[model samples]
Target chain A: MSKLNIKNLIKSFPSMDRPAVNNVNLDIESGELVAFLGPSGCGKTTILKMITGLFQPDSGDIILDEQSLLKIPTEKRGVVMVFQNYLLFPYMNVNENVGFALKMKGVDKNIIDQKVKEMLELVKLPDIGLRKPKQLSGGQQQRVALARALISNPRILLLDEPLSNLDAHLRDEMRDLIVTIQQKLKVTTIFVTHDQEEAVLLADKIALIFDGELQNFTSPKNYYEKPKNIKAAKFFGGVNFINAKKHNDNLSTNIGTIHYKGENYTDLNEDNIITIRPENIKLSKNNDFNNNSFKGLIKSVIFSGTHTRYKIIVNDLELECSLQSVGLQDIKTDDTIYVHLPSDKIWAMNE
Target chain B: MGGERLKIILSLTPPLLIIFTLFFGGIFYGFLQSLGYQPAIGKYEINFSAYYNVMFSERYAKLFWTGLGLNLWVSFASTFLAAVFALFGALAIRKTFFAKTICNFIYSLNLPMPHLVVAVGIIFVFSQSGLLARFASQIGLIGSPGDFPVLVKDKYGLGIILAYIWKEAAFFFIILMSVLQSLGENFEELAQSLGANRWQRFRYVILPLVMPNLFSASIIVFAFSFGAYEVPALLGVIYPQMLPVMAFEFFLNPDLNARSEGMALSIIIAIIVMILVVFYFWLTQAKIRKD
Candidate 1:
C-alpha cells in the first residue's frame, strides 16, 4: 500500500477558458478508498485521469509514496482504472483480458494462468474464462473488468463511475462487491461518481466537488449533517435557505426571529443565511414542543413510500418538512400545523 | 404467400436482369472465349488449349508467368504497405484537433484524383529528368541528372508500386478513419491503465478492433490493383508487364485468334483475386469465431 497525494493540481483545455480542474489538493491515505462525489462535469473523472497519467496536469505534483508521478507514463504508474463501460478487449476471451497486464509484464504463462484463475474466483466468475466479453451479461462484464484491473496488483485503483451502467439491483450488488474486494485487497482507491448514495455507501471519506472545485472533503455523516457550504449541503439532500439578520443572540427572519444558537457562526452579524434540512424540521399541531417553534399552514403534502414530505408556509417563507410514514398520522394539505426548527440543527452561515 | 413471392420477384427483376446481363453476361462470354471458343477467329470448338497455351506453351508461357508474378507483387505490396501507412496516419491524427483537421484535408486530397494522373504526377516528380533531379542538380548534390536514383520505369516496378500505394492509401485511410472515429479511445485508455505499453495497445487492442474493416478494405484495393491497367501502362517497364497490361496487349495484337488467350489471362487474374478474397474472409471468420 502506498499513499497518494495530489497537490494543487490544475488543468485547462485550450478550447475552454475556464480550467477543467482548478488547483485541487487531496491526500488519500494508504489503503483508504476515497470517493470523488460531484455533479456532471465537476472534474472528478478528469482528476482521476490525471492521477492515472491519462491526462497531464498543467501544474502541481502527484506524489505517490514521496515520489512525483508526473514524470511517469500511464502504463508505468501502476494505476488501473475500471472504465465506465468496462472496455473489455473484443478480441480476447475473459481469461486473456484478465491476464493481459501480467502478459504485458512478461510473466511466465503458468503463473499468469494461476493468477488469472485466482482473480476470476475472487470476482466470483470462476467457470467462464473462455467466454468472450460480449457473451456475458452487463453485470458479468463488470466482474470481468474488475478482475482484470485487480489481477495486476495495481498500486492505486481508479474506478470511473463503474456502477452507473448497471441496473439498480445490479448496482447494489456490484457496489457491495467492489467494497468487499477493496477492503480485502487494501489497495488505495479513488472512485468518481455523481450518485451521492454510492459514494457514501462505498467510500471511507467523500470529496464533494462542484464546478471544478473541491467544496468539501469529510466523512459521509459530516457531509449530510455538517456540510461546510450550501453546495455540499444541497448535494446530500434538500435544504431550505432563509435570509436572516443577526442581533446579538437572536436572528430575525421572514418566518419570525428565533434565538439561533448553532456553532457555525462565531460572531453575530447582520447578513447571514440560515439553512436547515427538511428531515430535521418537526411538524406538529401542538405548540409546546421546542423553543424555536412557529405556527404555519401546510401548503402541500407529498406521500413518498419512505416518508411524507410537507411544504409548510409560515408567514411569507416556505419550509419543506419531512416526516417518516411509519408511526405518523395522515397530514393533509391546507391544514394548520406548528413547525419546530431545532436551534442546534439549524445551521447558520455567512452568505 | 405465392402472391407475396411474385411481388418480391417482380420488384427484384430489374436489378437482377441488369446484374446478370452486364456483370455475369460479360463474365460468361469471357469464360467461353478463355476455353478457346472465339467466334471472331473462327475457332468454334471449346477446349482447354487457350488456357494450356497461356500457362505452359512456348510462345506466351514466360510472359504469362512473369506477368502473374508482377501482378501478385504489385497487388500484395501496395495493399499491405498502403494499409499499414494509412493505419498509422489515422491513429496519429485521431485525437489532436488542429492536426486532425489539417491531416484529414491532406489525407483525402488525393482521393478524387485519377490513378493515371497520379502516375503522371509520380513520373514528373520521381523520374530521372524530373523536378527532384532538377532540384538536386541545382543544389549541386550530384554531378548531373543521371546521378539521381531511378524511381520510375525501372525493372523492379518501383514506379507502379509507388503510384498504386499513393492512390490506394487514401482509400484505406478513409475506411480506417471512419472506424477509428466511431471507436473512441476508451479501449486504448483502458489498456494503458492496465499496464499495456504503446505498442502492446496498438497490437492487442487498436489493431484487432479495426482489423475487420482493414481486411475488407485491403481486399478491394488488392483486387483493384491486380486488374487496373492505366496506371501500370503509363508507368511500367516493358520487360515484365502487369497482368492487366499484358492481357490488354494480347487484345491489341493483329491476330484475331489471340483474343482467346487474352480472355484466358483475364479469367486467370479474376480467379486469383477471388481466391485471395475468399482466403482473407476465411481467416477473418476464424478469428471472429475464436474471439
Candidate 2:
C-alpha cells in the first residue's frame, strides 16, 4: 500500500474565481521522494498544506496507512513542513530550535540534546547549535530548519520550495544534503518546487500541475520524453511542437509526411500534435537514409557553454535542436542540414 | 556623505533645541530646586535638606512612604493587567478579518481620549454615587444609593488604577496588533507543524516574539501612571494618596518652602523609574543570553 494517498482533493478560496486546488489525487509509496512541480499559484503548495492539515481541503480524503487523516489536527497529523524562508525561531538558538519538537513531546532534556547534535551532524552543521538563527548564514539556517523538521521522526516530510532562498551554489549543496538524509532515513518525502531542473534532479517522481489541475504525474525522464499534454511538455522546455494528423504508422504535417513507430500514436486521434525534445533531434550534414528525415536551413545558433542551440527552418515549421558543444564546430547559421526526428522519440497528443 | 550629514544635522536642529531646552532644561531647574536652591526666596545655598526631609523627616516620612507604595501598586498593577488583556485581545482578533477591523477601530478609540476625560468617566461609572451605584440601588442589588461599595475614592487607589488600565490597554493593544499582524501566522504555523499544541505555540513562539515590545510598552505605561497627577487627584482619597497627588498637595501649600519638597518628590519618582527601566533591561538581557 502507498504510504500517503490523496483522493479527490479540492479546495477554493472565496477571493479567487477558480478553485485554488482542483480534484487532485496522488499516491506516494513509502520511502519514495516525490516533487509537486508547478508554476507559482498552481496549487502545488496547497496540496502539500492539505496533507499536513494546515489548510483543510474543502472535500477530499488524505489517507495514511489506510486511515483517513482529514479529521486530524495539524499538530497531531505526524507531518512536518520546512518552509521556503527557513522559519527557524529567531529567539531560540540552533539547539533549542532543532530540539523544539522533542521538547514539546516532553522528551528528556538529555535525549533532546543528543538528538539535536545528531540531527545537526546529519545536515553537516554541527557545533553551531549554540548560535542563534540570525547569526548563521542562509545555508546554515536552512540546514538547521531541515534538522529541526527531521528531529521528530515524522511520518511524512514536506519541503515547500526549501531551496528557493539560497544562491545557485548553495542550492546544489542543500539539494545533495536533502537527498542524502532522505535516502539514509528512507522517509516518505514530498517537496514543492517550480524549478523544473530541481524537480527533475531531486524527485523520484514529479507531479506536474497547471492552473490548480494535475496535468501529469510520472518519472522525470518520462516527463521529458512523454508529457501528458502540450502544457506539461512546454513546462519542461519542449518548444518543437508539430501540429499534424496521425495516419496509422505515420504522421502528416505541414512540412511533409513523417514516419514514426510509437504505440502512443495508436490511441491518439487523427488530428494531433507531436512534440520532441531539442536534444532528440539529430542534425547532420549528410542526408540520413531513413524515415522522419527533412532538409532544413539553420536560422540561428545560440552557443551556450554546455550546449549549442540551433533554430532550423524545415519548410513551414521552425524546429529547435540542441547539440552538445563537444564537436559542433562545423555547424553555423545558414548551413543546410538534414534534420531527423527519430521514430521512437516522437510523442503525439490529441490537439 | 558629508553633505548628507550636514542635511541631517540641519533638519534635526529644531527638534533637538526644543527638547534640550524644554525637557532637559526643565529637569535641571527642578533638580536645583530640589537641592534647596530657591532663588525666589533668596536661598542660594544648595543642600540635600529637601531630599532628607522628604525621606527621613518626622513630619512627612509616613506620608512619603505610604504614597510611594500606593504609586508603585497602581503603576505595576495597571501596566501588567493592561498588557495581559491587550495581548490576548490582539491574539484573538489577529486572524479574523472582519472582527479585526471592527475591534481595531473600537480599541483605538480610547487612544486619543484625554486621560482626564477617562478619569472623569471612571468616576461617573464606578463612584459610590455614580451611575452604576444608582443603577444597582434601583435593581435592589444594594439597599439604597448610599449602600453601594466604595469603589472610587478608596485607599487602594482602585479608581485610579481602573482609569489608567482603560486608557493604557488601548495603547498596548495598538502596538501588539501591529506586531501580531506583521508577524502573521508564519511562526505559529511553523510551531504547529513541529507538533506543538496551541498553548505551546503561544508560550514558545508568540510570547517570546512579542516580549521585547510588550516590555518596552509596559515601561512607558508604568512611568506615565507613576508620574501623572490628574487621575489620582480626581479619584484618590484624602490620606495615603499616590506620590504624584501627594507631591501636588505639597506644591499647593501656601509656604514657598514647600515647593522644594514637591520638586524633591518628583525627582525621586524620576530616578526610581529610570532605575527600574535599567534593571528590567538587565534582567531581560540575562534571560536572552541564557536561552
Candidate 3:
C-alpha cells in the first residue's frame, strides 16, 4: 500500500451546508515531500486535519502503510501536523514538550532523554530544553516545534503554512531548516501553503487547487510550465495574454500565427484565447519589423531593482513585460517602441 | 507670574474640583472617623482609644482570620479551576466534536444571571430530597430524604465548590475561547507535529499562547470569588460562614456599635482580597519573566 492514500475526503463546518473539503483524493509516496498549493480558504488545512485524524472525513478511505487509517485516533495516526502558528505548550520546557509523546507511550526516561536530545539536535536546538516556548523567538519556536513533532518519529509530517508567520528572512531560514530536517528523516510530508513560490521551492510534487477543486496534480516544473487551467497559469508570476483568433491549420494571434503545442480540444474553433509569457516578449528599437512585431508607446516604466517592468500600449492591445535591467535603454513613458512576440512562445488556448 | 502652565491648570479646574470635593472628601472623612473623632456620629472627642481597643480585640482576629481563609480558599479554588476548565473547554471545542456544539451553547448562555440562580440549581441537584435522592430511593438505597446522602450545604463545602465551578468556569471559558481562537489553530497544530500529545500540546503550545488571557481571567475570577456573597450564602455551609456572609451579618446586627465593627470586618475582607490580588499579579509577573 502507499505510505498515505486519501480517497474522497470531505469535511464541512456547521454554518454552511456544503463541505469545505469536497471529494478530495491524494496518494503520497513513502518519503515524498508533497505540497498542497492553493489560495486561502481552499480547504488545504481541512485536508491536513483529515489526514491527521483531527477532523474525521465525512466520507473517505485513508490507507496508511497498507492499513486503513479511518478508525485511527490522532495519537495513533503516526502523522505529525506542524501548524502555521507553531503551537507549543506554555507550561513545559522545550525538552519536556519534545519528550511528551514518549512519556505517553511509556518509554523509559533515559531513552526519552536520548531521543529528545537527538531530535533537538536534528532541529539544531541543542541544550535549550529547559527554555519555554515564550522564551524562544519566532524561528526558534518554529524549530522547537519541529523538534517536538519529529521527536515522535512519525511516518508522515503535515505542515500548514508553518513559515507564514516569520519575517521574510526568517521565513526563508525556517523553510530551509524544515527541508533539511525532512531530508534527514525521510518522512513523507504534506506541506500546505498559498505561496506558489514556496510550493515550487520545497515540494517534490505540487497539487494546485482552486476554489476547493483539484485543478491539477503534477510536478512543479510541469505545473508552472504547462498549467492545466487559467487559474494555475496565473498562479505563476510571468503569464500575460493578448488578443487572438484561430483559423484553419495554424492559430492567428496578435503576436503571429502560432501552432498549438497543447492537446487539440474538441471545443476549440476559430475564436480562441491566446496566452503568452511576459519574459518571452522581446523589445527592440526597430519599427521596420513586420509580421510578429507591433509598434507601441511605453505607457509606464517601473524600476523594480533587479528587472524593470514596462506597460506598453500598441493600438488596442496593452501588455505588461519585464526586462533585465542590464544594458537596456531607459525608455521614457509614452516613447514609441517595437515589441516582438515569437509565434512558438505564445500558446493559443481554447476555452 | 506663570511658567506657561497656568492655562493647563485652568483647563483642569472643572473636573478636578468635582473629583477633589467628592474623592478626597470621602478619604478625609474616613481618616477622621478611624481616628475616633467623627463629628457626624457625635463622637467629636479626638481619642485613640476606639482604634486602640479594636486593634487588640480577639473578635477582630476572628474576623481577620475568617476573611483571610475564605478569601484564600474561594479565590484560589475558583481561579485555579476556572483557568483549568477554560483551557480544556477551549481546546475541546477548537475542533468539531459530537457534544461540542451543545457544550459551547451552554458555555455561552447568559453569564450575568446572578450567582444565586446557579446556587439554586446546585441545591436542586445536590441537596438531600432532591433529584439525586429520588434516584437513590428508586434504586433501593434509601427510603427518604433523611437517609439520602448529604452534599449541598454540607460542612465539607462541596456545594460552594460546585456552584463556583459551574458559574466561574463558564465565565473564564468565554474570555479564554476568544484568546485561544484568536491565537489561531496554527500554533497548536505545530505543537502536535512536534510529537506532543493532547496533554503536551496544551502544556507547550496552548498554555503559552493563552497565558496572558488566562492570567487576566483568573484575576477577575479571584476578585469575584473573594467578594462573593450570593452563591456561598445560599449554598455554602453555616459553621464558619464565608467572609462576605460574616461581613453582611455584622452589618445587619441591631446594635449601633456593631455597625462599626461590621465595617471593620468588611475592611478586613477588602484588605485580604487586595493582598490576594497583589499576590496573583506577582506570581504571574514572575512566571512571565521566567519564561
Candidate 4:
C-alpha cells in the first residue's frame, strides 16, 4: 500500500495566470525515496508545500496512510520539511534545535537529551551541540537541519533543494550522507530539486515536472531511456532529436531508416520524433553497425576533461555525440565519422 | 590609507564639533549648575547642596519621590503596553498585502505627529467633560459630565500613559513591521513543520527572533517617555506629577537658587534613564548569550 497519495492537486496564485501546481498526482510507497525534479518556478516545491499543509490545494486530496490529510493541521500532520537555507532556529543552540520537536511534545528531558545525542552522532557532528547555528559552516548547518528534522521521526520527510546551497565537494558529501541516513531510517522521503544529477543519484523514483504539470514519474533510467515526451527527454539532456515517421517496425528520419525494437506506436500522434542520448550515439572511423548507421561530418569538437562532445552533421541534420576521450584517436573539427544509433537506445516520442 | 583617514575625519568634523559644542557642552554646563555653581547669583562655589535640596530636603522630598514613582510607572507601563499592542498589530497585518499596506500607513500616521498634539487629543477624548463623557451621558451610561471618571489629569497618570502609548506604539509598530517583514515567514513555517503549533511557533520562533530589535526599540521608547516633559505637563495631575513635569516646575521658581535644584533634578532624570538602559542591555544580553 502506498504511504502517501497526492490526487489531482492544484494551486493557483491570484497574481499568476496559470496554477502554480496543476493536477499533480503521485503515489509514494512506504520507505520509498522520491524526488520532485524540475527547473525553477516549476511548482515542484508547491506540491511539497501542499503535502505538508503549508499550502492548501484548490481541488484535490492528499491521503496519507488511508486518511485524508486536508483536515489535519500542519503541526499535527507529522510531516517535516528541511528548507534549502537551513532555517535552524537562530536563537537556539545545536542541541536545543535538534530536540525542539520532542520538546514541543513534552517529551522527557532525558530521552530528548539521549535522542539529540544520537541524532548529532548520526549527522556526524557530535561535539558541536553547544555551538550556535551561525557558528557552523553551511554544510554543517544543513546537516544539523537534517538531524533536527529526522529526530522527530516524521511520517513523511520533505527536503527542498537541501544540497543546492553547498559547494561541489560538500554537495557530494551531503548527498552521500542523505542516502545513508535515509536508508538506515527507512523513512518515506521526498525532496525537490532542479539538478538532474542530484535527483538521479538520490531518488528511487523521479517525478519530472514542467510548467506545473507532471511530465513523467518513473525510475531515473526510464527518464534517460524512455522519457514520456520531448520535454522530458530534453530536460534529461537529450540533445539529438530527429523528426521521424514510424512505419510497421521502424522509424524513417532525415538521417536514415532507424530500426528500433520497441513498443508499437500505432496510437501515438503523427508528429513523432526519435531521440537518442549523446553518449549512446556511437562514433567510429568506419561503419560498424548494420542498421541505423550514417556518415557524418564533425562540425565541432569540445574536449571536456572526461569526454569529448562532437556536433556532427549527417544528411543535413545536426546530431550530437559524446565519446570517452581516454583511448580515442585524434578527432578534431571537420573530421568525417560514422555515427550509429543503437536500436535499443532509440526512444520515440510525440513532438 | 592615511589620506583616506584624513578625509573621513575632515568630513566628520562639522557634525562632531556641533554635537560636542552644542549637546555635550550644554550637559556640562547643566552639571555645573546642578552642583550649585551659579555665577549669575554670585555663588561661584561648587557644592552638592542643590542635589541634597532636591532629593533629601523636607520641602521637596515627598514631591521628588512621588514624581520619580510616577515617572517609572508611566514609562514602564507605556513602553510595555505599546510594545505588546504593536507586536500583535504587526503580526496581524504582516500577511495580508492590501490590508497590511493600509494598516501600515494608518499605524505609521502617528509616528511623525507631535506628542503634545496626541496629549491634547487624549484630553479631548478621555477627559471628564470630553467627547466620550458627553456621549456616554447622552446615551445614559452616565448621569452627566461630572459622572464621568476622571481619566486625564488623574493621580494614576493614566492620561499621560495613554498619550505615550498612542504616540510610541506607532514607533514600535514601524520598527516591528520592518523587522517582521525582513524576517519573512520562513522561521515560523520551519517551526510549524517541526510540529510546533501557532502559540508554540510564536513563543519559540517569532518572539525570540524579534526580541533583540524589540528590546532596542523599547529602550528608546522607555528613555523618551521617562525624560519627556510635554505630555506629562499637559496631562498630569498637580500633586503627584511625573519627574519631568516636576523638574520643569522648579525652573519656574523666581529664586535664582532654585535653578540649580531644577538642573539637579534634570541630571538625576538623565542618570536614572542611563542606568535603566544599561541594566536592560545587561539582562537581555545575558539571555542572548545563553541562547
Candidate 5:
C-alpha cells in the first residue's frame, strides 16, 4: 500500500468544449479502498486513467509517496488498471496473462509459475490457468483480469467499473470477491463506479464526482445522508426539492413552515431550498408527533416489495414518502396522513 | 426435406458451377497437358516425358533448377520483407491524426499500380544509366554514371525482389491496417499497464493477435510473386530467370511439345504454393488450439 496524491489534475479532449477532468484533486491514504462514484461520463474513469498514467493530464502533478509521476511512463510507474471490459490478452491463457508482468521483469520461470499459481488460488480459479479468456465466462474473465493486475504487487490498483459487465447475481458475488481480495492484498485501490449501491457496499470512503468536479468526498453514510448539493442528493433516488422562505429559525414552504437548522439561509432575499430524501419523511396518523408535521392526502401508493411508496399532496406540493411495509396494507390512495419532516434531516441549501 | 435440399442446391449451383468449370476445367486441361499428350504436334500418347524432361533432361535441367532457386529466393525474401515492413508501418501510423490519414492515402495509392509499372519504375530509378545514377554523377558522389552499383537486372534478382516489396508491402499494409484498427488499442493499453514495454507489447500481444491475418496476407503476396512473370521477365538476368519467366519462354518456343513442358512447370509452381498455404494455415490453427 502506498499513498497517491493527485494535485490539480486537468485533462481535456480536443473534440470536447469542456475539459474531461477539470482541476480534480484527491489524496488517497495507504491501504485505503476508495471509490470514485458518479454517473456515466461524469469523469470518474478519466480520473482513474490519469492516476494510472494511461491518459496524460493537461497540467498537474500525480505524486506517489512524494515522488511525482509525471515523468514516469505507465509500465514503469507500477500502477496497474483492470479495465471495465476486462481487456485480457486474447493470445494468452489465464496463466500467461496473470504472469505477464513478472515475466516482463525477467523473473525466473519457476518463480513466475509459483506466483501465477498463487494468484489463481487467491482469485479462486486455480483450475482455469490453461483456459483462454474467450472460453471463460464473464465472471471468470473478470477474475482473471483482477488476478493479472494484482500479481505485480502494484503500488496502487485501479478498477474501472469492473462489475458493470456481469449479471446481477454474478455482480454481487464478484463484488464480495473483489472486496475480499482487496482486503487480503491490502493494496491502495481506487474503484471507479457509477452504481451507488456498489459504492456504498465496497468503499471505505466515496468521492462523488459530477461534471468533472468532486461533489462530495466523505464516508458513504455522510455522502448519502448529507450530499453537498441537489445534484448529489438526486443521485441516490427520489429527493424532494422545496422552495421555501426562511424566517430566522424556520423556513416556510407550500407544504408547511418547518424548522430549519442549516446555516446557508440568511434572509428572505436568499434563494433558500429544503431538500429531503423520500425515506426520511415519516408517515403517521397522529399530528402531535413533531413541530414539522403536516396533514397531507395520499395521492398514490406504489407497493414495492420492501416498502410502500406513497405520493402525497400537501397544498400544491406533491411529495413522495416511502414507509416500510410492515402493516401498511390497509393504506390506499386518498388516505389523509400526517407527514413528519425531522428538523435535522431537511438539508437546507442556497441556490 | 427433398424440396429444401433442392432449394439449397439451386441457390448454390450458379457460383458452384462457375467455379467448377473455370477452376477444375483449367486444372484438368493443365494436368493432361503435363502428362505429355499434344495432338497439335501429333504426339497423342499419354506419358510423363515433359515432367521428366523439365526436371532432369540435359537440354533444360540446369536452367530449370536455377530458375526454381531464383523463384523461391525472390518470392520468399520479398514476401517476408514486405510483411515485416508493412506490420511496422501499420503499427507506427495506426493512431496518429494527420499522419495516419496522409500515410493511409499514400499507402493505398500504390495498390492499383501494376507490377510492370513498378518494375520499370525501379529500373528507371536504380539502374546505372537511370535518373538516380545520373544525379549521383552530377552531384559528384560518383565520377560517372557507370560507377553506380548494379541494382537492376543483377544475378541476385534484387531488382525483381525490390519491385515486389514496393508493390506488395502496400497490399499487406492494407490488410494489417484493417486488422489493427478493428482490434483497437485496449489490449495494448492493458499490456502497458501490466508492465510491458512498447516492443514487448508488440511482440507478445499485438503480433500474436495480428499474426493470423498477416500469415493469410503473406500467402497471397507469396503466391502472386512466385508465379508472376511480368516483374521478373522485364528486370531479370537471362541466365538465371524466375520460374514463371522460364515457363513463359517455354511457351514462346515454336515447338508444340514445349507447351506441355510449360504447363507442367506452371502446375509445379501452383502445387508448391498450395502446399505452403495449407501448411501455414495448419500451423496457425494448431497454435491457436494449443493456447
Candidate 6:
C-alpha cells in the first residue's frame, strides 16, 4: 500500500496572511526515506507535525494506507516523531524512555524489557539502559530518542531535524545512525533537516521547500543534478548561475560562448539559466576534450585540505570553482588559466 | 575573579539579602522573644517551668492543640482544593483571549483586596443575615437568619475555609498558570500524539511537568492559611479563636504568666512551621527523584 497520501493540506496560525502548509500534496511509499529540506520557518516541520497527527489541518485530507487519518486521534495514528532537540524526557532513563511507547500501548513488562533490549542493541547503546538523558551525550540521547520511537514498530517515523543540536563530529555520526536504523526498520521514514549535506547523505528522496512552498521533491541525486528552478539551484552548493542566451547552435554566457552538448539545442530560449556546481569546473592544462572552457585570471583561491576553491572573476561574473589538488596545475592569483565547465555539468534550469 | 562572576554576585545579592533580613530575621526574633527570658519581661533566667506550664496548662493546652488540629485541617483541605481548582483554571485558559482575560482577572483580583476586608466580605456573604441566608429566605428554604445553623462564629471553622479558598485559589491560579504556560505547548501535543487522552496527558505529562511549581505553591498556600488571623477572627472570633487569635489573647492578657505562655505558644507555632518546611523539602526531593 502507498504509506501516505496528503491531498491539498492547508494549515494557518491566526493573524497570518496565508496558510503555513498551503495546499501541500504528496505521496510517500512504504520503506522509503524522504527528507524535507528547507530553510528555517519554512513549515517543513508543520507538515511533519500534521502527518504525525500533532496538527489537524484546517482543510483537506490525509490518507495513510487507504485509511482516512482525519478521524483517528494522534496516539492511534501509528506515527512516532523524534524532535530536533532529541527531547528525551529528562525524568526517564534510557530504558524507561525507550519503552514509553510500549508502556502507553500497555505491553507486558517482560516483553517490553526484551524489545527495549533489542532496540537498544540496534541503536548500539545496549549498555545505557539505566542512564538518564542528561547523563548521556547528545548522540546517545539521539539514539535513545530513535529507540523510543522504534519500540512501538510504528507504521511511519517522522523526524524533525533530529540531529540539529549535535556538534560537527556528532552530527556526522548521528546522520549515519539515522540512515542505518531507518533501513533496518524498513518503515516509511521522513527525515527533516535544513543542512543540504545531511539531507543528501541520508535521504533516499528529498523534498526541497521554500517559504512554506514545495520547490521540488525528488531523489537527492536528481535534485542536485536537475534543479527545477533558480531557487532550488541556489539552495544547493551550485553557485555559478550564468544567464544564457541561445545563439544558433550555441548559448552565450558571462564566461563567454558555450556549445550545447545535449540534444534538441535548436529549441532557442532567452530565459534559460545555466547552473554549475562549484566543484564541477575543472582547472588543468591536459586539454581533456573539445568542450567549452573559460580562460580567465584566477582572482582568489581558498585551499581546503582535499580541494582548492577558486573565485575566478571573468567578465564581471565571479564563478566559484572547486578543484582537487590532484588536478592541480600550479595555478595562482593573476594566472591565466582555462576552467573547463563540462556541458554535462552545466545545468540549465527553467525558472 | 572573573568579570562575569562579579556581575552575577552583584545581581543576586539584593534578593538574598532581602530574604535573609525579612523572613529569617523576623522568625529568629520571634523565637527568641517566645522563650520567656526577654529582659523586657523582667525575667533574667531561662525558665523551663514557664515552658512546661505553657505546654501543660488545661485551658491553654486545650486551646493550643484544638487550634493546631483545626489549623492543620484547614491548611490541607484548602491546599488540595486550591491545587485542583487552579489546575482547571490554568488549563482552561489556553492562548484564547477570553480565557486569558478571565484568568488574569481571577489571579490578580486579590492583589488590591485586603485579606481582612475579604474575611468581612466572606462573613457578610455566607453568614446568617448574609446574602446566602437572604437568598435562601427569598427562595423559601429558611424562615429566618437565626435558623440558618450559624456557619459564622459556629466554631467549626467552615467559614474560615471558604474565605481561605476564595483568596488562596486565586493566588495558586496565578502561580500555576505561569508554570503551565512556561512548560510549553509541545509536550502535551507530543504526549497526545503518542496516544494519551487529555486525562492521561495531564496525569503523566502535565502534572509531572508542573509538579515542582504545584508543590511549592501548595506549601506557600498552606503556610499562609495556617498562620492567618484576620479571616478566622472575622468569621469565628468570639466562639473559639484560632491559634493566632488565641496567641493574641495571651499576648494581650492582664497576667504576666499568660503573656509568657503566649511567647511559648509562639515557639510551638515556630516548631510546627519548621516541621512543615522540612516535610515540604523532603517531599520535593522525593518528587524530583521520581521524575
DockQ (Cα-based) for each candidate: 0.82, 0.70, 0.29, 0.76, 0.78, 0.43
Residue lDDT tens for model 1, B1-291: 999999999999999999999999999999999888877768889998889998899988898888888888888899999999899999988886756788898998899999989999999999999999989999999889889998899867888989988998999999999999899999989889988898998889999899889989989999999999998898898988888998999899998788888999899989998999899889978977776
lDDT of 2 by residue, B96-215 (tens): 675667888888789999999999999899988899999999999998878888878999999998999889999999999989988888888889989999999999999999998999
Flag clash pairs in model 1: none
What's the TM-score of each model vs. the native? 0.96, 0.95, 0.73, 0.96, 0.95, 0.87
Each candidate: RMSD to true structure?
Answer: 1.8, 2.6, 5.9, 2.1, 2.2, 4.6
User: What C-alpha lDDT values do all the predictions have?
Assistant: 0.90, 0.91, 0.75, 0.92, 0.88, 0.80
DockQ of 2: 0.70
- Candidate 3 has a TM-score of 0.73
Model 2: CAPRI class:
medium
Better of 2 and 6 by DockQ: 2
TM-score of 2: 0.95
> Candidate 1, DockQ to 2 decimals?
0.82
DockQ of 5: 0.78
lDDT of 2 by residue, A1-351 (tens): 139999999999888999999999988999999999999999998898898888999998999989899999999988999999998898889999999999999999999999999999999988998998889999999999999999999999999998999999999999999999999998899999999999999999999998899998899999888888899999999999999897657899988888877677678888989999999999889986577889999999999988999999999689999989996759889999999999889988884
TM-score of chain B of 5: 0.94
Candidate 6 CAPRI-style tier: acceptable
Q: After superposition, how far is residue A80 of candidate 5 from its true place, in Å?
A: 0.3
lDDT of 4 by residue, A211-295 (tens): 8999999999999999888899999899988898876567887777889776747755656888899999998887887888999
In model 4, the number of clashes is 0
The 10 consecutive residues of candidate 4 chain A with the worst lDDT sum are A262-271
Taking the tens digit of each residue's C-alpha lDDT, what string does model 6 give over B129-175? 89998888888899977667677766778888877777887887888
Top-DockQ structure, candidate number: 1
User: Interface RMSD of the predictions, in order shown?
Assistant: 1.1, 1.6, 3.5, 1.3, 1.2, 2.0
Question: Candidate 1: RMSD over Cα atoms?
Answer: 1.8
- Tell how far residue A201 is off in model 4, in angstroms: 0.8
